[model samples]
Target chain A: MVEIKNLTKRYGGNVALHGISFDIKDHEILGFLGPNGAGKSTTMNIIAGYLPSTSGTVTINGFDITEQAADAKRCIGYLPEIPPVYPDMRVEEYLTFCAGIKGIKRPDVKPQVESAMERLHITDMRRRLIRNLSKGYKQRVGFAQALLGNPKILILDEPTVGLDPAQVSEVRALIKELGKDHAVIFSSHILAEVSAVCERVVIITKGEIRAIDTIEHLERSMTANTLLNLTVEGEKDTALRILKDIRGIKEIKYLNAADGRVSCQLTLEDESVRNEIMSALMANGCNIAEMSMAKLDLEQVFLKLTAQKEKRSSLQDLLDETPDVSGEAPQDAANDTTE
Target chain B: MFALYKKELQAFFYSPFAYVLTALFMLIFSFGFITSIANMDSNTLKFSFPEFFYNNFFYFIFIIPLLTMRSFADERRGGTEVLLYSSPLSVTQIVLAKFLAIVTVFLFMIVLSLFFPIYAACTGKVIWSALICAYAGFFLWGLVCIALGMLLSSLTGNAIIAAIIGEIVMEGLLFLDQVAGSRLVDAYPHLNSVVTWFSMQRRFVYFSQGMFRLEDLVFFLSVTALVLCWNVLSIEKRRYSHA
Candidate 1:
């Protein structure tokens, strides 16, 4: 339902968004994953017609955002990174006003406002002044405002930021429920939240798209090795020697253990090694009580992709024999968890 | 537009700003009216409401800015501009609605000032037509100031800066006419006339003097329209640039 092409944005000498392109299918909840300044919010603003891209086009349901802003925006309900809320007005009045601005007719406004409140679970706080409401409530009010007019497209930027865990879960549930009928696109720095809620995920870094795929596919694509955890009730030295004898084994390391059981993690270079190791352990007469494989999760996949990109840039620096990329190493590593 | 207007109006009334402004206006009106009555001499029998209003338009110079400076400035500082920008409404509609809502509060003040005139007329006959023309002129002048202030507010998200810039612009326009009228150094006579046209007090002279010149009406209307239009365009550009 949304198509963005050649979207580029710059702030003076710094490029905020660099010729990115993507399509959000109808009724799909597309999670836009990026660290801060990755152009996630910029892309959301452009799609909502709140900002003009430097030299690109965004169309919603066949209407260009720039050329046909009203029509394009009519289909969108946007919640900016900062919740846009008027503190003086009560929650209900604010939502009603948003409904009017969204061009809901007088007769349809009440029901629409009620439904939005219901979805966000803010019906009780409807009578309280927004200034008096808590931050989580204000965020929900902003969400309710975005749901006005029942727009077919919802663009939410960091919708759950600053909310408590429960509130965050509530908003996530609402977004997931919204995905059932609308084309929902939300940006988030939290990798797990996006993976849990979005059907498809797009990872962006430095204004460029890094990868886009299903959660499992992204995990599988980025994982280079399969890690296995084994709890063998035997002497550590003997188990290590027997495991070393197995063919196709690439790497092995002692992990941890409880009581008399010994555990070690094994890395296989190929898929065939898993069955090889199983048979080898059985042949060694090792009492294997538990064996678990560790696959790359979304967080690990994200870090691996971003790290690979950073590694490529470092390789370029090494080829050029410069040390600036080396200097940026600690900073980029620090920014990952910070974002 | 109605949604924005309603929200702004409700914001004004719910906060203490409107009450403080109204109370301040009433104080000024009562003070000005009481002084005028006490100082009324028997020799000037033809004294009209127009002449009285001419002496009082400067109050709007102070009050109008105070009323309008926070309209858009507070919204930006408070992060409510996000809500407005994300909505389906056009910036033009939002700007106009905010402008009108501030004028609504100013209108209440103006109507309340009418009580002074009524009390003055109770003691002696006053020219009602001249009073109306002057009131229309004052309202239009206030409209221009509100548009200008709202435009200035959009230029900066800081409320203090918005208020300061609003005061500077409004006060600057007033002094432009004063400087132009002076014969100290006659370098640009035509430019002075144009500057005089912008002077809020000078523009009100014709209407307050019981003259309904189309030129004055068009001039005020166009100034209000241009400022409001620029406010809308600048806000939209800023929003788009940030997006």
Candidate 2:
């Protein structure tokens, strides 16, 4: 229902989005995952036709956003990061006005407003001023405003930002329900929220798309290198030596030692290495206290993906222009001599 | 667009803003009305409603910026500009809706001020033609001021700053009228013609004298339209260069 092609946004010399492209199919809830200042809101604003992209085009329901803004906007229901609400207006009055601006028919406005209020469970606060409502309720009211026109696309920019856990879940459920009929683009920095609600995710960082795939696909791909968390009741060096001699163990990172128990994270080449390491440790009088394969969750996958971009960029910079390390080498040698 | 217009009106009337501004408007008009009557010429016992509207405009100009200050600035500050921008309405439509809402409030003030003329008519003689001409001239001048005030509001997203700048600009326009009539401008015929052409007060003088020239009408309307167009452009520019 939405096709964003080569979307680039720049604020003067600073690029907010660098030719990012994505599409939202009908009845799909595409999660837009990014950390703060990752241009998530900038992309959403462009898609919603609030801020014009510096370059590229956004086509909604086959209508170009700039040329056919009215028709294109009619197909969108946007709830900005700040809710875009008038605090002085009553809930119902505000929703009705939203309906009117969205170009709903006069007679249908009342029903649409009421149904939106009902869906958000804000019917009771219909007469209350929006400023008087709590933050959660205000968010719901903003969410309810988006549902008024029953648009084909819904762009929610961190809809659950200020809500409590229960309210967040409620909003997730509502987004899930809305996904049945609309193309929803829900953005949040919370990995769990995205994993819990979205079928497919787009991970963005530093004005670039790091990875775009299903949650299962991303987690499964990241699990190629198995991480085993092992704790042994022995000398830290003895436990490390036993684990190092075993085949299929790639790398070992020491965690901490306490109460005669030494803990470390081991990267294994395969699952078969676990049995060999355990047997070898037992023969060395090292008692196994804790051992488990650490599954890579969405959080870790997100961190690795976002962090990998920075590492690759820095490595490329080193390859392109090797900085002068000769001046720092003498300082390093002097420090080593002192030590 | 009508929905936004209605909401803008509700923003004015729903709060105490419209009532307070309108009350202040009537107070100024009543003060002008009473003073004009008290200062009537003893020899002819004549009271010129046109002259009264002319004298009252200096104070009335201050209120136009107040009426228009919140039109765009409040929306921008409150983050509701996104709603308007993302809506099915175009930039021109949004600007027109807001402009018309403020114009409606201004019209309400003008209509309320008519009570003075009607009351004076009942007690004494009144010239209806001259009075209507003055009302038209005043309303037209107000339209230009309202558009300029809205442009300032949109340019500066703070209501108080918009109002202050609006007062300064309106005072500058009035000052331009004084400068146009001064001996310095009068010394140069070409400069005087250019200055007098842009002077709205000189055109309004023709209007107060009951001369409904299409030149002044077009001038006021075209200036108002120019300002409104500028307001629309300012909004679009902000969206484009949004930081």
Candidate 3:
């Protein structure tokens, strides 16, 4: 279990994390989602006891990171964005050393190392030097290192970054397996990967958390307009006109194409109109090649949340520069609610 | 800490760094040994092997950095500092383990130098008291160099920077006697004794002469302790500042 309360971190004048608080329950896999320069790594470093938070406190299983760092760190395993590895050391040797540092009993080290290597499917490369391994292999070795000592809490930053698609799937499966016993928090900018592997998602932007919820919940909360993608072998103008006549149709936009077919995006006021529009298109002369409701992917949700934050901050800047007193009250109230 | 110490000690030998350094240590010290014995043969004055090593403690100026320069710098450069920092081990333990590893390597080299003395003892009369004094002085002097090199290694993640800074500190202490002779103490007569204490070469001279006084032994030990303490403090300061 991990509890971070009002955690604030600043590098001189630049605030990396601002009074952010979050709790990770036991055995839950939480995805930390954010763009570049979004303070994800900074927060992970603070929680792992690698960097000091500017203010506030962090506790792992009731042990404070600053006051009881050794005991606190003992319960947690961290894989930094850059896999901390010694290039010259062999994979088996590196894992053995990691196990030792993590305080595995001397006699238990070999079996533990073997089990971890097996979990990451790195048993074959045990004798090979890490520097000579490929990036995907290196990442797996890094993951294997974090899996040492079987710590209760695992904090991994961008665990699937720089891996091939197959390797990413393997790592995702590995993380999912880890979630059965350990509280895993992995940070990533890859939205789909987080949705696939993490049970809960914490969306962050510009040093602050925007929302934390399940993937389905995040989609439900931000999705108001229903999008429909329709590919038809008909005149573009006739298709647009027919769709516009349908009730609940808000707007239509012609999509780019070169295949002698008209493809258009239909925005609906209500999602229930999907069936009506599909039936109407079929009845008309338009032959619908493919028709499906455009679902709001994680990428859309992420962009919406971050873009909302940018809007709020830019509006605040405008309010700050304005000499007009009338704009101050609403702006101040918005800022209060956001904080 | 033991885990770190074991890994670091093994790391030195796994790569060419430790092997090269160990071989270089033997080469340099043998040169000093052969030269000292050859000179003593000409003068007909008795010189023990350890005594000759004590007189050439300045060889640490070249050897100690090679032993310790990669301790933290290589780890930091390689991004392995993350693993060390994230582990349950305290920074003090981490630094101490690394220092001990380098000391072990230096000790191995020192043990190898013992063969030279054994050869001399078989061929001539050996002075035991002088040999004890010289070994004590050499061990403590090497300790000082190890501590100093560890401190320099902790200052940067760059191996070259660590080595350069380590060389400067060791060479600076070696040249302290020269500086004391040519400039500050020469120009300021009243400051001679105070400045002379800073010269590591002058400090080792008493032990080389077979004088194992507690004051001289304590002085070198204290310097070693002080540098180690400074290294621990530096690591702690960086931790809290970044935290």
Candidate 4:
């Protein structure tokens, strides 16, 4: 388990991460999502022991990152955004070096290097110098190096960036397979990628964590009132009245009523009320031409949550200018993210 | 520390860096050797291998920069520093490993150039003590250059800039002995004394004359230690820097 408690980082006057706290359990794959310069990399670097935190503490299993850095770092395999590699070294040689430095037994270096190359499918490139390899191959070599020590925690920053679509899916599948045993944490701007591989996500923006939850909950959280679109052949007022009369229908609005067919949008209290609304429309002499529920994907949720964070911060700034009238700051702004 | 040290050596040898530096040093030393031997009678100072070192140092000043240019600077530019920093290794280990690797390369280059003295030994009478002192003094001088170059490399991510700055600083250090004796420095006795003490040429003067002085050995070792410590400290500072 990894516990990050109120980790903060500051670069002189500019703060990169603010008191953000989160955790990853054993055998879990946590996705880190944030816009550019949103502290995603900062948090990962701190956890990977590449950078020191200004305040708070990070514990890997039971070892503090600052006091027991070597023990904690031994459990982590980090692939930075650029895929740190030496251009002059061959892939196998590089992995061997990594294995040695990671404290693998001298006799075990060769076998561990071979295993990592096999797992990353870079066995063909083992003898090739890293500089001669393509970008995709270089990235694979980097992954191979990280897997050498077989650490329990794998922290990859933008692992799939700059890869072709096929390689992206290949890496994603590999990460999912790895997730079954090791605790994996990877950050990416690609929302679908995160949704596909991650069991839980932490969305950060402007140096603060905006939301954290499972993939399923993030979509449900964004849909405050599920929007259902219906194309009906009926009079606008009669259709509105009938939909309004339904017990679970929250609101109804006609999108286009001038034509013979009227397209209307309805606010649904619950998705389970679809059958009741369909039956009510038929009984009221309304011909439902087509009906579909809007798909609020992770993309929309990410945008919505990030937008709300910005809007709330501005609101907070306005509130800061005035007296402490409410006697409390709005602390539950992200609570609705898990709705 | 051992793993990192081994990797640093491999990095130097696998590329053209190690071979090129050694070959360059040999070429310059050979040219100086032949010239000094031919002019043996013209100069009051005999064609001693130790005396030739002082003249050949001009070539080494340029060679040493190339030898140490990529120590830390290349790691930063190539982005491999991240791998080292995030590894289970400590910052001190990382710095010390690179330092030892470059110093080893330098020692090998000096040892290879021993062919000139060996050839002279076979041909005629040789000043054995002066030859040993020359080799020892040159090694110390090379180490000082390596430490200073390593320090400059750690200060920047650009290898070219590191090399340039390293050249300037080392050249300045080489001139400290002259600076101390200049008329301008006579105005400030304290500054002249301090500058002269850190002078590379001044400490090696006794060795150049085949005289072993404990104080001079202490000075060279102390300078190497101070610069190496600063190099380690500079990298440690990056641990707290903004990523």
Per-candidate iRMS values, in order, are 1.9, 0.6, 1.9, 1.1
CA lDDT for candidate 2: 0.86
Report the CA-based lDDT of candidate 1 relative to the real structure: 0.78
Using lDDT as the yardstick, the better of models 2 and 3 is 2
Cα-based lDDT at residue A305, candidate 1: 53
Candidate 2 per-residue lDDT over residues B46-152, each given as its tens digit: 88877887787789889999999998899989999999999999999999999999999999998988888898899998889999999999999999999999999
Q: Which residue runs does candidate 3 get wrong by more than 4 Å?
A: A222-224, A227-295, A310-339, B41-45, B48-51, B181-183, B186-190, B240-243
lDDT of each: 0.78, 0.86, 0.80, 0.82
Residue-level lDDT of model 1, residues B81-159, one tens digit each, is 7667666677888887888898899898888888877886898888888889988988888888888888888888787
- Candidate 1 vs candidate 2: the lDDT winner is 2
Provide the clash count, candidate 2: 0
Tell me which of candidates 2 and 3 scores higher on DockQ. Answer: 2
| Sort order, DockQ high to low | 2, 4, 3, 1
Question: Candidate 3 clashing pairs?
Answer: A52-B243, A53-B243
lDDT accuracy of residue B89 in candidate 1 = 75
The TM-score obtained for chain B by all candidates, in the order given, is: 0.92, 0.98, 0.90, 0.94
Task: Write one digit per residue (lDDT tens) for candidate 2, span A254-290.
Answer: 9899999998877767667878988899999998887
Q: What residue pairs are clashing in model 2?
A: none
Cα lDDT tens digits, model 4, A212-242, are: 7787665454453455678788898888888
Q: Pick the candidate with the highest DockQ.
A: 2
Off by over 4 Å in 1: A222-224, A227-297, A308-339, B45-47, B185-188
